[model samples]
Target: MRPLSFQAVRSLAAGLAAAALTGGALAAPAAAAPVHAPGPVTEQGGSGQGARLHTNTELARELKRIEHASHGRVRVRSIGTSNQGRPIWYATLGTGPTRLMYVTQQHGNEPLGTESALLALRSLGLGDDRESRALRSKITLGIVVRANPDGHHHGWRYNYDPGADPEYGEPGKGYDINRYHDPAVAPDDNPATEAAVIQRQYAAFRPSIMVDYHMQGRYAFPPPDGREITTSILWPTNDDVSAGALRAAKQVGVRVHDAFTGAGAVVSQYPGGSYEGIARNAYGLRGSASLLVELSALPQERENFQIRSAAISMVDLARAAASGALAGIDPARADAIPPRGPSLPGGSAAAARGAAPAHDAAD
Candidate 1:
């Protein structure tokens, strides 16, 4: 399939955004698979060969290893400690002028982002190829893997902060780290500890771009007729976000859409609220070109595929930013992406591919 450019897709925005097309130009996976397909090309190539969802301890060790392997080129440090006393690790690669920040696994269950980011860190720190060297020379990449280590250990959404205020998260279970990134709340005054750590890092780095990675429940336009969505993305939607920053964010979104779609994955505009506390909106309000990428949480059998999809996104976008192509992309093209369709019953990818016809429902 010939990939559509922003100019080509803009013409179909009206119809594409309105309804699920049965037989239009919407691209499907290159192979016979359901909506939760992985990208055809990965940064490291192969089927996510060595990617493993790491434990917090493993993550720390891996970061240190990458740091050592880079021979001081890459820096790894503990930003702060989580509620459970685990180190909230942060790693940086490259010394370039264009700064990029990526955070993954604010929600513990969404593990693919962390896995993919590890793969990306390995490639950036160790690869000696021209692209890797160029990326290192042109862009400084900072990544916070498993930002909410407590929640990740618990295999739940919020961080482990049982004593948090009622408005923090679930009060007893833990605070939802995602909801406490409000720029108005200074790091010292923040309720969620992990969020505060991220804020502190943000203040120090002040990245030009911020990409928050997450995973959504399985979703597709009810099988057979409608294709399953592989990934959904959104630019900062907060009203207070500056126009220029917002446009840059949209250009980033368009770049992401092109990257994933070209890799034979379905891409859509994420249905997100304009909550300033959410990382994407909060970071945008702080003058960064921010974006949220939600890869579909496919079945366990396809875990590697999901990792590859996310790695491709991270690596490709970095390359784009490094090469200066990101600045030339049309922000208006982001509007052409269709709003995400319904979540499959029980949030099952299998159900998404095999379920009977049904009406759209909120995720």
Candidate 2:
């Protein structure tokens, strides 16, 4: 891919700076700055190959298309409005007793997962296709295509809340909807109106599994046990690494690794050895198995590839979860897989040294 435009690079830098000044914790040391690599280039538009979605408008249009195409077999609902009043769209397919929730685009700038989700919806025949029908026959699917509309529209990471905190810094003023861990703040202290509605929906739905899609820093990291693990899945909080969550994560990881590896891409696990705390973990707190799929983002062009691979991975994971294939994976072994190389040096330690504090709706 062509070098990122000066403006695009500058925007990214600014966003990173803003995040540092905010309340979230940083992962790297002050001297160790995050680096950006050039991304690969690919033709734009969906020319009879896999579909490509890059913008909110396109995502919305695709949702409408799926709704129309499904002919009432699938139902689309507006869980609530974003901070900016944009509709937060979710599509529900099937009516099985078990409920599975998939969310993408919680961070506005990470749009690939959202696109992949749209494609998945269209491909599944909106609950009519044989595969979807079979899966739906066993489980209900709830998908939220975009979680932070305000950030998406502005291409920023946080929601549109403008209330700054002295402890968190100026950037912390806007509500990072993902940080609303407590269910007691106004609408449970969630900064985004849309998040509030979705939280309520999930509480009512009581989904068995929740998957949140996102992109990570571009630079590649060493895998566990000196082996590469592409498509890291953040394990939930349960000490039971062998639990259903970990099993589902591993199955999903294998699928993503295969897809990207086939396409000539290297995949690996998070070097930390276990999943970190985030919105996905929060979901886990509520008795649901939550998985956070983090795609590499350092080489920006890879964003598109990661998005596609993630979509494929999600399909495989969803199918397995629906079919009870993931029932045997133990949560205790969540980090059972070892790293393939020397661990990348960054984490809460790096955050303490000078890396910008973590900021974003998911913080």
Candidate 3:
């Protein structure tokens, strides 16, 4: 891999500053009803804004469009199919040796990651600026913008399959695609088809860094008057993860946390478990520095803000990784970041009292 030139780093830093300034502009809330059909309908595109998220067809079109517009700078292909036969597309941008794989929307209900990923695709694929070209020279980005199309179509957490897998979350509903990524399970043998698709892709890509994007319930930091955590992040914590891998994952977390927090988004370390089945831990066990990023599910009125926060984080990470800045980040800084506080209460009265809501496991 070629080293990032000093000029490239300066240019990337300048572009990131510009992105931070522009990401906060809000769009009108999407008025159309969220699309539910699995037809070839185009998705309501923009920041989330409680809008209908992108459908499979729309994602395909956008990926092809980016590929075409990039004049060969970007490439798109179908890695595999979902349980419902939806085309699971993978888009690639940049050609450098440092491979970064991002899988978004593993849970059907979480739409922000996919949305932000699209924004990132456009920026990296279409921009002809020095920073974009510079980053492209040092890193190759492999993005699976939507990993669970069946689950996404059903507007649920699990993939939509009536055929029960051993790890099925609810009978007749489907499997939580996120829970079936254990490296011990062969890609072809994985019961959850989406997990199999992702595992196959991971094996083929052999990325140095992999980031899983997800969404979690709303929470505030430090109780009353505390700021809402717009994004929470966690590194692989499985006991089997190597010390080198853990440190690299922490370095990734610290770089990302600093980038987004500087853009005015509140970020905290997520309270995630060390389950080997979870993607974060599984990928780490496979020797990739894995990080899981969970965007907060805020009220509908703030959907755009949340989308912007997550999207720019993606862009920033790409630039940092490409510029070799990520390699230099202090892993120790990750430990200094505050852990996410308790979930906000259900009612305004309860929230005012800082009463904790019913506890649920962090996805």
Give the top-scoring candidate (TM-score). Answer: 3
Q: 1 or 2, which is superior by TM-score?
A: 1
Residue lDDT tens for model 2, 166-280: 2222365355555553344445655555557678878878887887776544333343334323354554544534455555555444444444454444554444322222556
Q: Candidate order by TM-score, highest to lowest?
A: 3, 1, 2
> Which 10-residue window of candidate 3 scores lowest in summed lDDT?
349-358
The models' CA-based lDDT, in order, is: 0.72, 0.53, 0.73
Selected candidate, larger TM-score, 1 vs 3: 3
The superposed Cα distance between candidate 1 and the true structure at residue 31, in angstroms, equals: 20
For 1-363, candidate 1 gives per-residue lDDT tens digits of 124455533432222222112212111112323222222212232223232245566667667776766677679888899987988888888989999999998876566677677666665666566766878999999999879777766656678876766474676788778878888999999888899999999999999999998877777754454888878899988899999999999988888788677555788887788888989899999999999998776675575556656766777788788989887887888998888777766675433321111231111
lDDT, residue 354, candidate 3: 14
lDDT for each residue of candidate 3 in 195-274, tens digit (9 for 90 to 100): 99999989989999999998777778885659887788999989999999999999888877876675567898988888
Q: Each model's TM-score?
A: 0.81, 0.69, 0.84
Identify the superior model by TM-score, candidate 2 or candidate 3.
3
Worst 10 residues of 2 by lDDT: 34-43
Task: Quantify how close model 3 is to the true structure by its C-alpha RMSD in Å.
Answer: 6.1
Candidate closer to the true structure by lDDT (higher is better), 1 or 2: 1
